[model samples]
Target: MDIKDKLAVDVLVVGSGIAGLKVSIELAKEGKSVLMSTKTQLCSGSSFYPLKASLGTQVTKNDEDKDLFLQDIEDVSHNMHDKDMAKIYIEEIKDRVDEFEEIGIQPYKLSDNRKACFANHGRTIYMLRDWNKIRENVTGILENYSNVTVMERSVVISLIKRNDKIIGAFLLDKNKELILIQCKAVVLASGGFGNIYKHNLNPNDVDGSGHILALEAGASLLNLEFIQFIPGFTTPKYKTLFGEHTLNYCEDFVDDSGNSILDEILPEGLSKEECLEVRSTHGPFTNSLVSKYFDIAMMKQIMKTRSEEGFELIYNKALYENESDFYTIYLNWLTERGINLLTDQVKIAPFAHASNGGVQVDHFGKTNVAGLYAVGELAGGIEGANRLGGNSTGACMVFGKRAAKDCLAYINENSFIEIDSQEELNKLNESMKHFSVHVDHSLTPNEVIDSIRDIMWFNGNVIRDEQNLLSAIEKIEELRKSFNISQFVDNVKDRKSAFKARNFIMLSKILLQAMLERKESRGAHYREDYPSEDERFNKRLFISLNDHELKLEFK
Candidate 1:
């Protein structure tokens, strides 16, 4: 096996998002040799991907409302969040926001009359600068850290564990060569699995590989059933997020056939105006509220038509003259992007936006595995059934810093294991041979991935039931059985695609199994067969792999 390179570091931070950046900075500040390997370039990930102009982090409105902020999170998520984790986030978020401002990524200067969206009360919204600008500011700060070495275009195929401790990781670089990095600790901050769905708003690199890597490394993932789906544009521009602020002004919600889509799915006695008003209050789809029919109706139309071209809406901006400061800024930003809601017939569909759950971690972002930690969207427990809008980014800051500081004790006590390049190369050789070995009539990796996306987007997204979940599981199993990595050892793109295909299969199966096991509707996870939340399943559910078999348990 051609092992491209071998190196050593005190810590290997996987990802380049807000969390990954924060972790690398903290470790570098402590003078620890840190290698930050990103699947893409710096400032690339969900955190820096501009989905909407009004996108920002949420914090407590005031110190007096700290308890209320926690209450809002609990109420919004249906009390499914980890109480301790939520508490940690609430206490630490203000400081993190301050750090952002100090680092030159300041919040937008909105008028005092600007109204908050998403949460009911005690939650203050800090409108962010353009995501591109935020990315520039963050990357600029990272440039000053001389102790950190960045390796881009690297995908972690797996971790190297000895006696159940993470000693290093195997990365496939852009050159299609395996690079091994021996480290005392591995921190996974690789965002979420939104891209696994055919329609999603996450960056292409957010493929849930971190979750799979942690799981295979003997870590548990929590609440895989809860994924947030929100509306995004389907025509003119693909995968652009559709903000809900304009929905209240949109009068005609129709499909290409000129049929009223929302009217078809709206419950009896519920006016379209009332539904739109409630739906505009939140961005993500939730079963706990009546506004859910908005997303359901959109998904129904797409599923019924089986076409990527979704439904359209006509907006009359003149209907509402006194727009909130938030709405005015959002509209202007949309105009800057060359989208005019009044002149444009906007087409939209429910797109997989974020995941509320991931690898289960403690308050310090330490997983069950001793030397492996998970932070950011890769780590679960901060948000539960549904995520509060801004907590996603907030958790990244809080846990990222915490993990970096906490892992020091472990690194101080432990020394590097005595594993050489040849020993690691032998293992890599066996893995490559298993995948590259010829098979009869094998499908391409992209083919398998496309099929996986279709199954996930249709059955596991927006709407779910017993039959469809089981069907998806069966189809996923068939894909797994048929997925023989073609002889493309020297092909870099194809090799990465092959690994991504494998990761998607593992992630899809876990998500489908979790959805089926939940057996009730809760927040973002709605099961039409059991249309109400069951208290028995109220606790967080966790999944782990043992002896290559998936096991799930509820806490």
Candidate 2:
């Protein structure tokens, strides 16, 4: 690698997702030099995927609604949310949402808005109801700016740190060549770790690289155990997210038998329809918002039909007969697969959807480490244990722009100090070379991913017990020891795939470890061995690495 490959920028935004692009656009419009890089093409991440180009936004009715919204976030998080961060989110969300409208997005209001604290409570709006529109509109805005450089198919390998400040990063470009980016600040807007699971709704490239980047950099991540699993597809032959907006017309959760299983399991106080409606609003089962009975019923049905992968999610006849066209996305998704939502039953199982915890950061998306900011799903504290349906999108926009503002302020206050990179660059080169010298097994990337996915699916999924989790930990640890980068770096796709594979193992270990550490069942993460939610375990558990050793503490 030649020194000419080294490039300097005012800010390096890692990820092409909405959050990263949002931040890059913010800075670039202000005439700041910004380099936005993604492992794949623009709009190829979760932002443009199967979720039908949807993003959540919130518009405040008044100051009182903002307070109610803040309370709702804390309530959804099971009281484990960072209150100070919640305050900032509530304060900035309206302004952040207004920016989207300024960019030409028109959000439709729900016909029957829920209560002020619930999903789509009149305050909520969509960044773009259709996903492709987001790609077109958001990317178009970036194209208009002269100060931004969009680099596609660029894989970031490591962050460059010196004396407690992040100066730059090392990346493997699309050509399999190393490029070191020198920047005053770095914003990790990379999404979550959903792709690591067997059944997921994330892009192929979102294999928890952001989490790994933070972990190896010695930053703390909190509440990583709470992975939100929604009822996603199992019968389409290809996996995609089961749109939760259609849950409004759900007829029944019928078993192989002709009975509605939900009717039998729902507790006395909550009716089956009400419980399902609550879940339909958010898609994930959260004890703080709804009762544990919903998740218990769903997971029990999954276990009952475990041999067949999962059970059916049948739609009501009224759904098809209904005059409204609200379900265009669901109808089209079903009809395209030759399955009718009105007549056919779709197999529904818990799919790895959104991650609640990510790099622990303050209100400004700055991680505990200086100059390293995380936006969107890459940052924790906004969503807490279980995020509401529309909040994640709002969080990303609010924090993404906040990170940009803070990044600019930090750059103005401080100048980049010259540091020696020769030694660190050599070590990186040696590590890459070390893989080639030690290649032994004819190991493939898919095999590594498949093995880890199964472990997470069976052991660390919706309902997990102590024995299964412990066994998963052991097996994953063994797999971790056996995996080598050299086995899959022969090709560019495989090299990026290899990077994703490595992050999957490392992040799954952290997830399972966190799950094992939490004995009580709370929100998305459940411990069947200790089913009760304990008040003593209410605070968030954060983890950091010290000299490669795990350190756990509470915030």
Candidate 3:
């Protein structure tokens, strides 16, 4: 009941990644009091991974490049993206990139030769090699804005909704006390639920709580079925994502038994060079590629190993002479593990890299729920099925700013109305009372999280079938029965795990149910039962809660 940082602000941004940070800085610059809260450390989300810099976007030198870029996004989106949003994103984002460049945070072209940058697609992407420096630059500017109050370890427990509008939120401070956040608007940039999978690059804190909060507040999520599965090293030290270009050096994607998985699936027309170019452009394995069959084989192999290494990415060192930047990272990763990049074979598997769909938002990051906005990986529809390489970071900058500007406009026109604090507090208190009820003594959040990972990896991973997805749903439902939030609240030691577990469970059910609804393969959500993409199922799937019942629809 000890309220901390309970002061009012024009906007409350729930996250600390590029999206959240961008919103806070933008609004604060305009002299609006902005509260940016994170569940963990300031720079600990997917954006601030300690090991390596996440892939970023390329700069478009001219209008023609921009046009081609738009087309590329549409093509990769499987014609399912919001066409207007794509245009708005490309045109509006250029200015943001220019702003970054002016501020000394810049990106380098992925390849040396500009003309034949990519044979499969005629384009070059820019990646920020000095990610830490750029991160420091952004965070540094944010400090100059005294209007931005950043709170770490402050998680948004739930939204305070009244009369179909989001008026405030219940925040859990570091002291584990309830803080009623009364604000005009809330921008959710809480990142993705990659951690929901057994193998992922997401930190444990990045569990899908944002999605859960949106659902509880009457927001609908679109395209929840499209989770991008990219090949990354999952052993020795996990979640080391190979640069897409670096993976091009991989002459073959082989298995431990010396079987060339690529050989088994490589199309008759696609040469080894063409195969590399296509794979490099599209980071995740796609059925669109002639070599997509390799991904299906890779998924099977990874599952077959279950708890061990299975695939070897073979590369010819001679071919790597021209590759410098990306090759260095790949080489360093191997060298650190005492394996020679030139000699030792690397075993990699598909990782839940990014979520293509999230809380359905408009061009301005406005969700279905009024006064609630979502940005970054938390907002969906930007990337339809599989996202283009390095677009995640740039899109965050673009939409985060848009959300801030729109939220500010909304707040200026609409005054912050006072509400009954006692009523909201009582609602939360009632939910907390259920924590200790009907709890099994042996059941813990860790146990539940592991079960979720196992089920999702096996049934809801790179490839899926009806039987496994339905089984996953059943298993998740049964796990929910064994443990409840009251159990975690009663056990203070596992409070964090319990809350995070609830979010993961919510995300798992949403994803699986969406998968069940979509019978055909499209982009990343692949169904083995329906092996081919169907025009009938070309629409996006939407998930939302109606009277606590999960409802799914597609159009």
Candidate 4:
């Protein structure tokens, strides 16, 4: 086993999204040596993906409105949130927003000063002034820190733990060589596993490798079942996010068979107009509202047809006046992209947009493992079953800063443990050989990924039941058995894909297991067998790896 290089830093940030960059900037300001490892380039991941023209970061209008904001979060999450973490997020979000504004990520003020998101009340949604500018600003800020080392195209394959504490990590660099990064503290700000699904709005690099890294390093992941599924375009272009605001003007939806999609699937007593109107208020699919039926119908039609091309939406101009600034901006952005809501035929289906569950962390982003932390979409607990639209970015900012400050203090007192490269290299060699030794087929890594995505999008997707989940778990088991990692890891790119496939398969299995365990439908997680929320399952299900087996505990 040939190791490329060995380096040490005070802190290692395993992502380059808002959270990773935020924490890096904070640590660099304190003169700490921070290594920011990104799978791709800087500002890449769901945080900087240009699917939306701008992202809305939430803040309260006044101290009086804070209680209402908290209530909204609890209500939308259906009492499935961390009460303490939620309160802390609300208390610190305003400061995070102000901090970003100073760094040129200005927020666009609404005329009303407050607007509702996902059924929340008095929520002042500060749309980031411009998505591109925000990316440039963050990238520039991170670059200015001489103490920060930005290692692009470096994927963290595994964390190096000594005595149950994170002392270092093994990074697979762009050259297919291994680099050992020893650090006093590690921040797992890596984004969520949206790309594991067939259709997702996240970047290709947004796989759940970070979660697997943490799990292997003896960290627990919370609420692995609560994933946010939303509508995304399937035609005209793939991977484009379907704006929920368009639902307000949705007159009808027709499948590829030229039949009304909502005609049969709409629940009794819920009219098409009423359903679409209710669904238009939020971005992600939720069982807490009547709009859930809309997502259900879309998913059902897509699954039944098994079509890559989704259903078409008939737009009604009379349904909306487009008076709101949010609507105007979104509509104009669509027009600029050659998509006319009224004239164009828009095809959409339920796409895996984001994961509301991830590595379980406290308010300061500390995981169960010592010297390891998580933030952004990678960390869970602050936003429970379902996350509010803008709160994702807010969590990144608040928790990212908090984790950095806390970990900086840790680094000041603690010293890095001895990292043995020879032992780690021996393990890596054995794993690589084991990966190739068992394989009999020559399936490309892309094909393996496609197979996993198909299984997840079908069985473990929005609509789940006992039978389908079992089928999915079984299929994933078969796929893992058939796919050989080393048969395809001949080059740098191929090696990366192999790692992604392995992580995706493992994470998908865990997610399906979580979905199967949580029988009751709540927020983002829905089960056909158990159609209602259950009080017995209100607590978060934390999943961790122990003795090479997965363990689940409720807290």
Candidate 5:
């Protein structure tokens, strides 16, 4: 398990998603030796699954100004978003978009030579190609860089800190052997905590590894309570079948019985355009008779059908057969694009997709800790509450570039400091041994993880109350106790699988604890008990560990 013979680099980028890859590309272009690690393979993160769209307001002469964009973000965030950090993100929007174009991302355009608009911003752009194609193109470019090294199937176990600064990291390679990667700078582009919930759209590997790493390293986190739950997804085994792009096309919302509820909310025969006109007056989800009609009775019917048929009925039919039904139906109406969904109804429900709250960092990506920087989903306070639909891609590009810029600057300004790999190995060995002793028969990792996800979905979902939150905390505590005693049948190499489950449990607890503390319904942190948004809790909520205790403070 010793890594004394391992290699070293100038920069270490963890998680090979868009954020990490972009930073590695930028740093490699600058002639810095960059090493990027992926928990699985490159492009396996959430970035690859996006329906080929980029969201953001690029700097322009008309429509949206930097100040106005900041205002919009602040308004959505309820002032919880860090103004300074948001300003940095706003200032870089145009440059980042232009950079993407320079790197071969040809965006689709309207006849007027402008990108299509979405979410009150004109900067939203859709890719003319598929998302997987974009990832392949970017990967091809990255492979050409001589200074960049790609380590597939490597997991960062812990950050190596020296004198309150990050020196490097202890990594577990594919074979589960410990290897120490010494680097002058570390960029955590590791994505969000969506897997903490049971019915999430995020990958199972995304167990908030980066967040927990930052917390263990004593870095600060903000806005943990603001988990966004997107509306407008179909139910009966929820799946995110439709991209928001189809919002421009579809007009009718159907209940489980396939009955159109549009007339119930709107006057009979009102066109989709007309519905949009009065949508502002009636409120977002309330006016949509479709969401209203899919009530408890509808859900009951779907459950009955599933019980009788031994398969879930999603849309008008079973979803798996009509793989592209939702996409096809919407695209055909929206842009004349063709898609096919078989029997599936494109079942959907809003679950946590991304984290707006993460390790606090400055414009340069420097966290409160001296040598540590966060990028991508790990770096928070930029998007605030509800991230604009396509803005995530832009944010990753901008912040990833900035983090590399600052990291390279740090490397040039400072001298290399050697770390003691033996000491780190000793610490890791002891920790591994402590967990290894619990090999007795008990709950499996999968069972414990399922329990954690179900608890989160039930208690910490879109609507919350003090009672549910408290009950969730108790449930999480009980689960954690079970996890501590859980046994793993797998060997040492597969022990990380068990550890991943444990990590999810710990993060779920933190998320619940943070959500319970926030007593206001601001942005995504909606508490039904405290239904109204409170002016007093208007600022960002900061959570940090104080002597093993989760401490809450407002920024």
Candidate 6:
């Protein structure tokens, strides 16, 4: 079970999502020995179930200009993105997409071979197929590469840095052994922190592991306050199951209690009044509320009335059955003729989905440190304040590849630094023994996790004020203190869950502290007290965490 005696590699890649897989495959193909690790199964991360396809570089008749693409990115990023680093990404888009196509990713194209416009310019592209298929195909290519070793159920506990240069990582192996992986380069492609909220569409393990690891390694984090909130799907029962992205585009809302609340709040362009008339006599639950926040208590009361009076107060039936995923199901409901809910307004509420700001990195995915690099959702300052829909997948793909390529290049140029495995092993042994003995079972890890999620969703989500953020920060700190008192079931599975929950609590504190420092509303970091976005506060915000204390500043 001891992993300290294991072999080393040229590059250590964390998280086997699309980003990690693609990058490792590329490096291995170039004859570099690469070791990739994932917290769970290879495809369990965010890339496997991405609701939409990305808009890559525009293929223009005029010379394929990277500057134009960079300009568009800066515009969407609200001028907060690093212009110099973004240039590298913009220039490589077409080549990257071509590489994917060569590997068998067929992107959907317009009839005239023109680009689609999700933003001001026609630059976005869609996949001709599904994401699961894409993930399978990519995984197959990675599997074929002999130089790459893929390790499943391995979690990266921390980065191994000496004198501010990252040389390797400390990984928790499947057998619960601390593995000291000595490598010339390391890449972090772990996905976002969507699971920080009580109700979110993200998977259970999306707890901001990469972000915390980077911060612990001395990487600079930017725009941690800008958490993206998507206005869609109602999870009346459970938070994780609602396909909010799908519901946002498909349904309409109706406040059937005869209150015209939907008419006042629904954004323009949607036919709100037409749906309102249909719901007045049909009952409240008869219509869908597309973007309006629901009162949880009110929804329960309405459901109760429907059950008692047989009034059919709320129904979530689709207007038409379609081939598309959950989002298309609701879209079909709105566009199709047979669905009654389409004629009625659907209720909608904003929930946290993505983090726009994260650890800042350069063109080669290097942080301020020499040997450390961050990829995927953990590497920030690229999306700026608000990330355009479908761009995250592309960002992960583009940056993941770049980080791996750069890491390999660095290894080829420099010699590997010597590391003492015994020293690392001794430290890990002491920590494990301490954790096993001192850890108490007074409160279950799941209970602590659930409480943190509830507090974050209530205070730090959607709209934030100074008072609420301060209260949330205090609660998160208290949870962190109590986490050590919780005891696992003394099994491998239970221990892993406990470790992940503890990491989540630490991450939640970072997010809460960042939210408290930002006073103005911009992109997804809306502040109720400040109310409006301020031009003077347009620069990016940065935070560094040391021993659980947050040092805040603007970049």
Pairs in clash, predicted candidate 1: none
In order, what lDDT does every prediction score? 0.82, 0.74, 0.75, 0.82, 0.64, 0.62
Per-residue CA lDDT of model 1 for 364-424, tens digit only, reads 9999898999999988887877777777777777888899889987898899996767777
Tell me how many clashing residue pairs each candidate has. Answer: 0, 1, 5, 0, 20, 28
Runs of candidate 1 with Cα error greater than 4 angstroms are 101-104, 108-117, 319-323, 428-438, 490-493
Candidate 2: residue 51 lDDT (0-100)? 60
TM-score of each: 0.95, 0.89, 0.91, 0.95, 0.81, 0.79
Q: Estimate the TM-score for candidate 2.
A: 0.89
**Predicted candidate 6 versus true structure: per-residue lDDT over 1-555, tens digit per residue:** 245445589888887766776677778878999888887776657666443333233442224545556666666566667777566666655556656553435676443332222233555454534656766776777667788887888888767777777777788788776677888878878878888787565776677888878887788788777776553334222222223333323333335454543445445675653443332221112011322222222323333343211111233354234455434644543444333333444344444667777777887788887777887777785677656444565666677777877877788886677887767656544443423434354446787788888887777766578887888888876666555522462455566667666667777877887777778766556665885667778788888876556788875
- TM-score of model number 5: 0.81
Best by TM-score: 4
On the 0 to 100 scale, the lDDT of residue 195 in model 1 is 91
Model 3, 1-555: lDDT tens digits are: 434446688888999887887787778878998888898877557876633543556445467777777777877789767788778777876677655543335666566423222222455455655656866776677767788888888788889877777888987778776678888899999998888888877787678889989988989998888887777775444566655666566777666667787765565876766776666655676666654665687777666666546477777687447646555666665566665545655667778867888998999999978899999899987788767765677888888878888998988887777878777777866755534347546468889899998889777888888888898999998887777677565555666677777777777988899988889888777888987889998788888787657888887
lDDT, model 2: 0.74
Error of 4 at 227 (Å): 0.7
Q: What would you estimate as the lDDT of candidate 6?
A: 0.62
Off by over 4 Å in 5: 1-5, 52-64, 101-104, 109-118, 121-128, 231-238, 243-346, 429-440, 484-490
Candidate 4: minimum summed lDDT over ten consecutive residues — where?
A: 428-437
TM-score of 4: 0.95
